[model samples]
Target: MSIGERIKAKRKQSKLTQTELGKLVNVSSQVISNWERGYSDPNHDDVARLAVELDCSTEYLHGISGDKLSSKDVLVAGQEINLTTEELQLFNELKKHPVMFHDLASDPEKKVKELLKMYKMKKMFLEDDEELGDGFGDLED
Candidate 1:
């Protein structure tokens, strides 16, 4: 499907009106209408924001790919953020944990903070263990 068609489809699927989608992306409903009508396209940053708000991938929106789940983009406090490969792997793993998945779905920021803390703790432990063979320690210093 075209980018405009994909946006409209995903918006409807999410049960959001154009106005609601606009608000999430910090745009006006008219802008969304224009997008759906193929009058204009969103910029890079807004495209990223749209992907996050629509729960899809920028690649999907751009008609570059069909795999939405492969997106490493996420929304945090209304900002579009890209996940590192390690972070994406951790996130995918977290999705398998019911409690963590619920927490992440409900409050992404908190879940992200928790994940960051866990990553730091793990890194520290690895760093302190000389037998670990500088797994992440070599990257630190």
Candidate 2:
């Protein structure tokens, strides 16, 4: 399918009218109509924004893929991160893992921070045990 057709189908699937989609992408309804009709195409930036608003990957929008994998903008430390195609694939794959989304979704950075702290603590304990001699319990008390 062409990019325009893909966009139109996605827009319909999302239950958004052309005017609503146009507002989201900051374009006029006529522009959206033109795009849907294949009279013209959205520019690169518009395509990116459209993909975000539609909760889809740019590759899907560009007809380069049919993955329909979702992506969202991530902001960390005031920096916006746009995930690449590989990252989007990884995100989709993560859903299949045993990890519960609720556990990781709430305060993700905090979860990672706690994991790092636990790892450091374990490492410190291992080093201290090694310094205390390999098997103190095995020695005659």
Candidate No. with top TM-score: 1
Give candidate 1's whole-model lDDT: 0.79
Residue-by-residue lDDT tens digits, candidate 2, 82-133: 4556543444454465443346555665553454455557778999998888
Report the C-alpha lDDT of model 1 over 1-141, residue by residue, as the tens digit: 778888999999899999999999999999999999899989999899999898897878999777564456665544445677777777666657555444355566666767756866887887778676746655544
Model 1, residue pairs in steric clash: none
Model 2 vs. true fold: TM: 0.52
Report the poorest 10 consecutive residues by lDDT, candidate 1.
Answer: 97-106
